[model samples]
Target: MNGLKGLYLEDLVVGQSASYGKTVTETDIVMFAGMSGDTNPVHLNQDYAETTMFEGRIAHGMLSAGFISTVLGTRLPGPGTIYLSQSLQFKAPVRIGDTVTAKVEVREIIAAKKRAILETNCYVGDRCVIAGEAVVMVPSRA
Candidate 1:
C-alpha cells in the first residue's frame, strides 16, 4: 500500500470518497480498552453491561470512530493529511462480531489553505453507527 501515492490538495474533487471495513472483535475491544484506558463496563464487563440498556457488552464508540481515521489516513487524502477537527454523533451501538464500514466523502475544499472538509460516517450493515464531519489539512506538492 505504501507504493501508492495519495492525492495532494489540488487533486481533490468535491465528491471524492474512500472507505474501509473491519469486524469488531473481543480482542479489538480489549486492546482498545487497554490502549485508551477506557475500561468502561459497557465495553469490558459483560455482566455489568447486561443490566444496562445495551443488554450486552458493546464496543466503545471511539473504537468505531477510529475506523474513520483509518480510512482517511490510508485512503482518501491518504498519508500526509493532517487532521484538524471532527464532530461525531454516536447513533447506535457496535457489538462484538459486527462488521463496520467507515466512509468519508469530500464536501468542501479550501485550496488556499490546502484543507478539506469531509462528511464522515460509519455503518454496521444497513444501520448507521456513527455520523460526523472532519477537517483535514492536505499537504501540497510544492
Candidate 2:
C-alpha cells in the first residue's frame, strides 16, 4: 500500500505511457490454477498439452492478464486506483518459459470525474498476447 508514488490525479497526462516487466514462472501458473480451480488438462498436464494446438502446456489467460493489474497497482496509476471496467482480447498463447512485459498507457482523462481511460497490453518475446483498455478511477489529489 505504501509503494504508490509519482502518480497523482493532476499528474496524469492523456496519451502518456507506462511499462513494467515481470518474469512468469511455472509456479505462477500452478498457483493460479489452484486458486482459480481451472484444472484443465492443457494447463495441468504437460503430456496432454503436448497434443493440443499449442503443442505444450500454456499459461492461463487470466494469469497473463494479472500482470496488467500488478503494473497498475504498483506503478503508473498506483494505489487508490479503482478499476471501473476492462475490455480485453487474448491474442496469443504463453508458454512456461516466456517472460511477459505488461504495459499501460493513459489514453484519455476525465478531470471532472477523476477517471482515466487506459490502454493496456501484455507482450511475450515481441508478440502481444493480451490487449485491452480499462476505465479506472484515480482518487483526486485535492
Estimate every model's Cα lDDT from 0 to 1: 0.93, 0.87
Residue lDDT tens for model 2, 1-142: 2675547779899777778877778898899999999999898898999999999999999998888887777787987788889888999998888888889999999999999899999998789999999998888778
Task: Give the CA lDDT, 0 to 100, for residue 118 in model 1.
Answer: 100
lDDT of 1 at 8: 92
> In candidate 2, which residue ranges exceed 4 Å CA deviation?
1-6
| Ten contiguous residues minimizing lDDT sum, candidate 2 | 1-10
lDDT of 1 by residue, 23-113 (tens): 9999999999999999999999999999999999999999999999998888988987889999999999999999999999999999888
Model 2 lDDT, full chain set: 0.87
lDDT of 1: 0.93
- Off by more than 4 A, model 1: 1-4
Q: Give the total clashing residue pairs for model 2.
A: 0
